[model samples]
Target chain A: MDDFVYLKNVVTLELNQEKCNGCGMCLKVCPHEVFGLKGGRAHILNRDNCMECGACSLNCPMQAIFVKSGVGCAAGILNGILNNTEPSCGCSGNQSACC
Target chain B: MTTFKNPEKAHSPYILDFVPTPAGEVPRVTGKLKLRDVLGTFMVRWSVNRDNYRVSPGLYAIGDPTDSSDVFVTANYKLSFDHLRKSIDGLNAWILVLDTSGINVWCAAGKGTFGTKELVNRIRMCRLEDVISHRRIIVPQLGAVGISAYQVRDRTTPAATATLTAGSAGSTKPLKLSFNGLKVSGGFNVVFGPVKAEDIKAFIRNNYHATREMRRVTFTFSERARLIPVDFVYGKYKLLIAFALFFVLSGLTRKGVSFQLALEEGPYAVLNILMAYVAGIVITPMALPYLPGRSFAFKGFVSGTVAFVLTLLINFPGLNFPEMFAWFLIMCSISSFTAMNFTGSSTYTSLSGVKKEMKVAIPIQLISTIAGLVFFIIGRLF
Candidate 1:
């Protein structure tokens, strides 16, 4: 995962240090080690590695983390454009297998 | 061929038996995978009956379990359920399954089918408090995106606060917990488990601690390779249309649309289309990391360029300059577009990154394809 990183400075992930209660929930739930504990608060260690999954923001008790997360699939985007809706991997109401 | 002892659910080959519980009869499952399960997995990998592949959503018993046995939560997708059951084989536990419309945990979670609402609903519907003594449920880490731990905790009222029935002094009546638009009964602690089900044993053995490695998601060669069959099959109809269009287009000549010329050159055009398909759908994914650029389209272009040159070398005597150049544009665009689509399958790509890539890549591909077709017609007709 260290060797494989996506585009840099593109993720929407932002942390509000003032609002953070040093709960460490972000560090515990992130699939990628995007969050690290620094001085008893959650810090974005690897911003580029963040896939915008929104796990950290959802679990954060103090609402310190904010990220506009959605399916990153190009097909999902194209689907959204075609259907005039938010991007989805055709996971809803479609029988086709999706990633 | 069948291991299940339940005569009522005779169609279900996987269920071992149904054990009567306080709420209802829960299906008992085994950890050992049968040949049928393996074949089903193979079919699923190939995406055959993929949409219909699912297990019934409800509570299941893995082994003989007491009231305090650890409860593991999972999706209704048979693959996810199977993996979870197999991972914790031989362990006595209760499995609370939520309906995810046959999708695996990570994908289903991302779509919100495996979210907090469904979890709360399932917990209430299954009367989990009447079966399990402990108030903790282990959920996979990948599913954390949709499941808000705090929301689940806050939504479910603690079992201690549940009202005791007046008529039931020592009666076996389950707790009468009602759910409105907001709250439900028997709040459970959401313990985020490892990303993969295989690590459940180690995770439980180590006192529910997941090492950093267990949380990280990886796209190894095998993992990437498994996704190929579905994607490869995806281009079949498009490839057939391309083949037909190119074959008819090959008949265009200076004098008129010539059928003899089509017979001579049509197969070559089809071969080129096949080359581009292999380059984009197969070669690009295989050589993803080794390919020169981070952009999937760039990698596909590189692979297509190589395939284009290879096609040139293979058909040198028959091909003229205009047709060769036409194919060069067509092959590169096709490969590039196909590779760009791979962003969907890739684990590391972000929505913002993909949006950025597509904005630049789509116009280029569209222009290249149109220009290539024009050049091809010019080469044939003029």
Candidate 2:
């Protein structure tokens, strides 16, 4: 967070406060501190900081968080383009890894 | 006590002997980190203690686990176990360490190692029915991807009669369904209650409660720090490995020279490869956030040019302008390749963004490196 400023507003990580129990599952799993607990519920402090890893969404018990997570690496993309495959980084799916 | 990497696999025959805990009773132990554990944690980060980095996967007791002792599940990556154990200061719990190929919960969950299937199977194989009185199995929140709370709840302790209906797969169905047909005769309930440790115990103890049922999870800075090493390895090591390979191959491929003469010229080849390493591996990452430019390719070029200039000024003063320019192009191109690879490790880049960057970046980098290589070879021959 010290020097890293990502491509802004890309992470569609949204949280429904009414459903959020603020169990802090999202807080623990998020690498970028995207969600913070305010009073009794969870709040998205910085939407831009999200890398779309979907870790928060996966960890959220209430199903209150959402993100269009996927592989953001270069070679994976280049390989996908060269091979004409829709390269998935496992961000959108829950079953496999992005690799 | 039991030790099996995969719950689906047979319990290692020696598991009982390996651990002193009684069968069906995982001992409760605080996951306190001693000096050795601290050392292993650091060693695992750098990947030096590869063998020493993992704990045996199976059922473990933190202190002396009883039927009522809490069960905290984690991966066999010893660092994860160590941290979890350490985090529980006064709590007595049975730790069910999963065989995640020595990866932590966050990573293993992504790969499906720390999922519902493993949890349900492990619970049955360990005879958790006899060990814990509670029907609940507390898993890390991050492991939710690999595990469906509904599946785990359905398939937990009593396995022979496990039934997972197709209706349960979709979110539209009832979130929590109780099947009377799958109920046991003794009224013994086996449910996959994947509760957070922090929510269950830590938050209550620390008075981390709101007016209602808000249970807080204590996420320490130290625990969060573990994720950094993987990212560091991903960012730094690729170009370093490439540099080493290039150095060895370039030293061997020199023509009209004895092997010894080629060996004698190894330093030049090393320096040439070193340029790419310095620019891509060292400077670019160290100054990543500050490296001016939206494009990583441009950032790498800038860093590579700096590396080329520094090496040229210090080591190769006799080079002509053409030779210097050729070397610059080569270094910049190689550096660009290395930098572009860092896109995955960066938070800034996305799938669409990287796809766009690569279509333009890769061709330019390839052309510059190739042309520079040709010019440098001609410069050397003339």
Candidate 3:
């Protein structure tokens, strides 16, 4: 029987294989098991599981990765849209009033 | 459809028919509740027990509210509901909740879920005109994005005042006109204040894996190596090429430059590489605040020069003209490259600023490195 995988299809992660230098750093750091090594190169086996954390891009030695990194919370996105700024979840700030 | 037994029936007796006095309001004991309890209720409202969403988005009365008690506005998200109830010190206040799809005021406002149409619809649904005689409603500042004050006034006769909106309307506006006046509005305000710093710190701590885990540190017999190549990968490769060129030039000047000679000369080669790396990676980030100049490139130059001087004092012992010139070139190159990395980290620097810095800095660094290589060849030959 094939192993079952729980996928969260909220975000997508893409890898430019031609730019990958086969540094297994992405595999070592991703909290989600999204990438698999195929023929000595890193292949993104599970794109939907990615949270768009930008970990792969930051760690890629060859500068071959990119992602739209942002919080998934609607509150933060609303603030960003209203203020014409990058959206951020208010969870990081003063907690006196925010739930 | 079955008549949804109004949850309001439980608190019906306490519901006040008029606006409460703002002063001498008894502080409610809602603040002492545990965060988990509040979050659990919110999760339930958002997920499994969905009636919290169906609670006829309108005004509510949480506790026994008197005519002279305070009135607060909020969303129906149980977490939001709990936050408002808990914040009051001892105030018997009317609670007006708008339907926001389980989202908070700031976000709901931004998405237009908490705008004039919803507020009007909710007020009408709850028969707010019969429950309270007051024409005022308080809103949070964060929700300003979603609501247009002008539009709300046009749609509903009730006056809407934001907690933080700049107004000289005196106290006569039907709404007491402060974000803090309403429990839900105040929640939005508090989240954007001092609590923001703690949130940022937590975010940084949690995301360290994203920031630092990409790079690895390797240790060699003579030196430590950082395996995580910096953003500008080409710079490191170029430094290696420059060193190779220096060695080739050294060989051309002499009959044969053996591996032993290269090893004996390893310190200089390493020093050049170390300077570039330090300026690019370590010094650029760590010394960002103390760098003498504002321009990131200039700061890198200063750091590179310092590193160069320190290396000369340790390695050359007695600095001659050739060594001093070569050292100068090496420092300049290392600093320029490191300074270029600033564009990646800063919030203020623009893309054009980075382009300009690179256009000027890269050529200077390259020319200096080449000049230093020429000097090294001349010194070895003569």
Segments of candidate 1 deviating more than 4 angstroms: A92-97, B1-11, B159-186
Write down the worst ten-residue block by lDDT for model 1 chain A: A90-99
Query: Which pairs clash in model 1?
Result: none
TM-score of 2: 0.66
TM per candidate: 0.91, 0.66, 0.35
Over the stretch B248-301, how does candidate 3's per-residue lDDT look in tens digits? 543433666766666566557566657766775567646655666545667778
lDDT of 2: 0.59
Global lDDT for candidate 1?
0.84
lDDT of 1 by residue, B23-87 (tens): 87787889888898889988887768788778777788889977778889999788888899889
- Candidate 1 chain B: 10-residue stretch with minimal lDDT: B1-10
Q: Better model by TM-score, 2 or 3?
A: 2
Q: What is the lDDT of residue B227 in candidate 2?
A: 30
Please name the candidate that would achieve the greatest lDDT relative to the true structure: 1
Worst 10 residues of 2 chain B by lDDT: B210-219
Q: How high is the lDDT of residue B131 in model 2?
A: 66
